[model samples]
Target: MLGYGGTSSPDDPTLEAFKYQKMLADRNVILSSCGIEIESGEKAHLVGHDFSAIFSSTIVFYYPQVALTCTLMSAPHSPPGRKMDLDVMEEITERELGFEFTAYRPFLLRDDSWQLIDAHKESLLQSCRGLTRNGSRTSCLRDA
Candidate 1:
């Protein structure tokens, strides 16, 4: 949450809060600050997509009390298998798909990517609302 937009600046203290194991407590602090009160037996429900899913599961693993329910979108929960960084995954992806993912391009590195994100926002909302391409509701949502 520290690195996420509008949160604390990316300084040493914030960086420390973002550490994997420490994030559970930090999340509680943030929630408390926001006037959220999770009852003793209540678990936080987490929703995540793509890379965020990793953080969601890891948080659940480190502190089951913090959260146990997760709804992951598009990308499934990919539990860590081995030590493979983005570079390694990029190579493997190129080999399999004959193309590079957008993260590699300095093209989408900063605010330059905002337009793309905005363009997809509506479709993303539709998928979340379980709407089909015809603007009809469906049991399962899929982008057209």
Candidate 2:
């Protein structure tokens, strides 16, 4: 979520750093859509299942006592700043990574990010589908 949301946008306002205030508004809207009050999730045990971990963790950063605890599934909670916002996956991973990390390519905040997203969409969706399908499919299927 580094290139996806708030995260110190006021100090460094850019389209890539989506506004925190706007994010809060959208969160409330989602809660409203689900018939939940804006404050109903306060002090709740939050769960983050991947990149959305930023959303879960940001709530805690804004309000330290907001969530009782957070369980991050795939991605770790990023530090509460945009200091490393401009670093791409290739540069960062090249330092310590011993192998290729293909999954991160699409989210490098590049102009062609949309194209990469499009390329990975089927695999991503298929991964989600495989999980929801509960063993019905063993892997992401390549489109014929």
Which one is best on lDDT? Answer: 1
Candidate 2 wrongly placed segments (more than 4 Å): 1-17, 40-43, 85-92, 100-103, 106-144
For model 1, residues 10-91, the per-residue Cα lDDT tens digits are 5584456666667657767766776665545556678767656777777666567766577776555555555646667667
TM-score (C-alpha, index-matched) for candidate 2? 0.51
Candidate 1 stretches with Cα past 4 Å from truth are: 33-39, 74-82, 105-144
Per-model TM-score on C-alpha atoms? 0.56, 0.51
Candidate 1: TM-score?
0.56
Q: lDDT for model 1, on a 0 to 1 scale? A: 0.59
- RMSD to the hidden true structure, all candidates: 7.5, 8.0
lDDT of 1 at 8: 61
